[model samples]
Target: MNRNKSLFYFAAFFAMVIYGISTTIIGAILPQLIDKFRLTGYSAGTVASIMPLGITIGSIIFGPIVDRFGYKLLMFVASITVITGLYGLSSTSSVDILRISVLLIGAGNGIINGTANSLVSDISGEKKKSRLSLLHAFYGIGALGLPFMLSVFSSVVSIREVFLIISISLFLLALLLVFITFPVAKKNMGLPLSEILKLINNPLLLLFAFFLFFQSGMEGVAGTWITTLIQKTRIDNYNSALAALFFLILALTIGRFLISFLLKHFTRFRLLQVGLIIVISGAVIIFSINNYYTTITGLVLMGFGFAGGFPIILSFVGDNYQSISGTAFSLIFVIALSGSMIMNIIAGVISDTFGIQYISILIIACVFIMFFLLYNLNSKMSMK
Candidate 1:
């Protein structure tokens, strides 16, 4: 690769790492925040839910800005936002401040996810899905690594101190990003509200958007509730539940690493269909039992199954709308996050009222829904 392309790929990988940390760090830090803020269940849930809203806002807003202005300035600002949010999180004892910090971090993550995916797709050209799959592997690494790092250092440094140190490292990374050159935006890429509205009204785009909706919702449900499901079902086995969760992420990381090779042998649509089937099978397995071996096996299956969804779907979007990919991605991401937020609330209700055991039923239903959405999405893309 040329220097620019190599640098862009590095940035893309870095962006995914940032996104992974932002996504998982909340669960890692939640107990600490609760202890510091004296949070009730409702308040804690509210705090958790509010971050997605910030993500949605960022997803909606970043595309046009990137399309108009390119990625450099936006990334610089986003990194700063994340650093500020982390510092705020470390410093704050107020419930409201903690929520705001989480929100800001989510927004930064949202921007990074959209920009990096679009940026990588733009740079990779024909290899969009393959490289995106590889890029997303770093997300798994970051997600899983944070907790591991905290575990390693928790004996010496507090979580708050760790957050502060991370903030400083990100500031340095942002400076490096400032010196790297990225792909230039198309001269005519910027869209007015009228054009953006028309773009959203496209039947194909809407189909993709809705597919991502269910996709993100399914993922959100699994990641958010899997530990709880394990704990509720197993009873007094928090360590095993935590281990199961780690296995899930490890499985996902391995699956992502494999995707680079898988894409060489399989078409994106075929892989997506296979992923859905695997997810369905895993869901079925998990729905039926409470054993660690069984649960971990199902999580691993689900991990490998769900791995192909984002890269494949996004490859189509980036392929079809090269000039406006950033904006196109924004639309789908916003819709996806919205769907995830809605499903999280519904899952909360179901788990709370009918017991957490019912969450398996919810997850299974989501998998089936994703299956159909994948079918429709594949059919639509094939037609193109």
Candidate 2:
């Protein structure tokens, strides 16, 4: 790769790391926030819910902007938004301010996440799936790092201090992005409304979007609830629960890294089918067994199982909608984030009404639905 492309790739990878950390930061600090703010369960859930809402809004708007304006300005501004969010989160005492901060973080990360994936897909040509998988491995690193940091440093430092440190690192990332060259806008004039409607109505796009719908839902649920489930069912210690969550993300990271290489040997469709099967198997393991090691094992399998879904499906979207990929991605992400938000809300309700252990059943159901969706999606692709 040339120097500019190499730098762009680095920027994309680093952006994903930021996305990863943003994703888990809420979960990592929830308990502390709850205690510090004296929040009720309902109030805490509201705070958790607001972030995805922000992400959804961000995903909805970014496609048109990136397609018309290129990535540098969007990424730079989004990074600054995230940095400000982090600063506010570290310093704020008011719940309203906290909510706003979370919203800023989520919205900023949403833009960065979508932009990074779209950027990588734009440049990766036929290797979009593999490259996207590799790119998301950095997300795993960021996801795992936050909880691990909390687990190790909670006793030594305040969570606020940790947030400040993370903000500093992100500020540096934002600065680096300013000097890097990026791909020009893919659709400088932007897609017409009629064209966007047609793309939205396209059957293949719908399939891919809903497939991601469940995919994002499953992931959001697992990422958000796994720590609580582990704590409630298997362990009483918070650190051990964080450890379980860490193992899950670690497995996901390793699986993505491996998938990047494995795609060279396996067809994307076939590998995705196998990954879905693994997800089902993992969900069953989590549902059937109660042992700590077994739960961890189940989480690992699910991590590996989930590793392929986004990269493969989003690659398909990119390949099919090359001219309006940013818009296409935005549509896909809007649907996907909707699924994430809805399912997370449902999971919260399930936790409140039926108990946390029952969450495994919801996960199992989602995996089965995803399996059905994948079959339909694959059949449709084959027909084409």
Candidate 3:
């Protein structure tokens, strides 16, 4: 890759990290938010799910906009939205205002989620999947970083201040995007919406989207509820569980970087299969482990297992549908975000009724579904 391409990749990677942080910082601080608001488990999960719900709406619209406009422009707009949204989140104490802010954050996230990997996929030519995977590794970095950063300063500072810092970081990145150039989509160079919709129906792409829907749900289950689940466990205390969850995110971040190297030697499909297996193992371990230390180990394995799936699936979409990369990714994200929202709601309900301990079993089931879907996807792709 040329120097510009390398720079673009890093910029795109940072965007992913920022987006990840925006999405997850809430998860890290959700327990506190719930306490402040006096919210039930279901309500807290609903608030957490709200952003992805907005992202689902944005995902549906962004494809057409990106096709009509361009990635650079859409990305700038998205970053602006994120900055405004995060600032809004920091400014609000009302539950309704908080929900609206999260929605805007989701909209901003939808734009970045849809566009960044598509841009990398477009620019990297043959290295589409690998580039996309590396970009997502940065997301892991950001998601992991949020909890660790918060854990460091959480004792001394407030979550509102954290939102302010994240917002400022996003605004600066938005300013930087003004100087960067991005690639145009091939089909979107001139294609009509009708033609784009036809292309969006590609069976392979749809199947991948279907797989990702469940994958996103599984990932959300862990990301949103891990801290809460830990708090309910035999951990040292609520504070200790919160700290351990951050460590789990850190493990996930580290695992993604390590897997980036491993991807050079393995196919995305093989890597996904391995991830599903690891998740299942983690879930089972969660069931068996009685001690807090063993529980953290299980959670770390779960995090490591999940770290690879999104990046790999996204890279697969970009690699397969080069011309309609943005559209394809948007569709996949639409379903995935919807899945994230719906399953979180479900997890909330299940936890409310049966308690959070059962979340491990529920997550195990989702991973098994992912395993089946990936196995089928691999089989079909091979036959083709």
Candidate 4:
């Protein structure tokens, strides 16, 4: 049993690794993509924005399927999707094909993300909160590592080669998933309409989902625009954008690990409030300042702030709705991805008109919006 758990955990780790790569890969290669494709700002934004659309679709679909059929199939299929997507990205020249590739890749990543979190929650029992935090910290590790990998190898290898190598690596990961036995799915043959209605109407669930919407939106903007913001502000020192991106991802990694310790003493709500304060401060600093160093600092601050919310909220979902946790998670994630999509799509349009600078201002507004949701969620959870 212990050995099986270890294998499952490794499977979960690589699952997140795939997601991390997919999540950051576009941002890492964006400049190169633009030069190679000769795309306009609007075209670039369109390409970038479509990824979340695919992710939202995958998130919406994976829940009930994973609940009924188990994680093995979905995870296997997701890995293959990521691999195929990368291959398409590596080989394609047409922006249309590029869009399709990234869409598939994003979908794959989202499925793995939702499935892995739900699986870890299922296995960890009462320790779901801390365990989920630790599991996702691997995601941060993967996300943080990829940009650096690209940075190091770019001089030696073409961007296409980089993605091709990643695709092969994912193939191995998919092959490995075949042999590891996963936890069995919940035995429900069908979801009742009444239960579906209850989930739809659950105020606490809606609040939690609403909170995540902003959470994901903030993350979407941070990941996609941080480099652009840095590049625009520091024309001569373009690499600093990558450096700042590094700091943001690293800070997120450290912050998630910090969450384990935080759970020991801090109530989840207090921790969440603290995270919000830091995120808001970062947003304000980035919006107000122009320096590259300040931008990095602001991003790192927001990183730590964004770290604690998802694990705690997902834990609440898992603990309360253990039987149908997959579907519940799916619902929340769909809402969250919609938030990301709305922000990215709007930010894309805004970027073409005003400037990427507005991205920070929008994130700041999102942080404040989350304040209201958190209060409502806190009130509800406290009563429960």
Best by lDDT: 2
Model 4: per-residue Cα lDDT over 1-384, one tens digit each: 889888877888777866777788777666667778987667777777778888888898798898888988788898888888888888898888999998999898889899988888888887889988888788899898777876666578776777776778788888888898888878558577688788979998899899999999888878877777777765545466777888998999899999977898999989999999999999889989888888888999999999998888898899888989988999989998888778877777777788878888888889889999998888888899
Evaluated against the true structure, the overall lDDT of model 4 is 0.84
Ranking by lDDT: 2, 4, 3, 1
Q: What is the TM-score of each candidate against the true structure?
A: 0.92, 0.95, 0.94, 0.96
lDDT tens digits by residue: candidate 3, 1-384: 387787788778888889888888667777777887888989988998997897887787677677667767778888888877887787777999888888999998888877776777778876766666677778877887777767777678676777777878887788878887655545545557686678677777777887888888877888888777777667535567667777677777777777778889987887888888888888888777766778888888888888788778877777677666667778888888788898888989988998878878888888777777887888888987
Backbone clash pairs for candidate 3 read none
At residue 213, what lDDT does model 1 achieve?
Answer: 82
Write one digit per residue (lDDT tens) for candidate 2, span 21-49: 88887777676777789875556667877
Query: RMSD in angstroms, all models?
Result: 2.3, 1.6, 2.0, 1.5
Question: Is candidate 1 or 3 superior in lDDT?
Answer: 3
Best-fitting candidate, measured by TM-score? 4
lDDT of each: 0.77, 0.85, 0.79, 0.84
Off by over 4 Å in 3: 185-190, 236-238
List pairs with backbone clashes in candidate 1: none
Give model 1 RMSD, 1 decimal. Answer: 2.3
Instruction: TM-score for candidate 1, please give it.
Output: 0.92
Ranking by TM-score: 4, 2, 3, 1
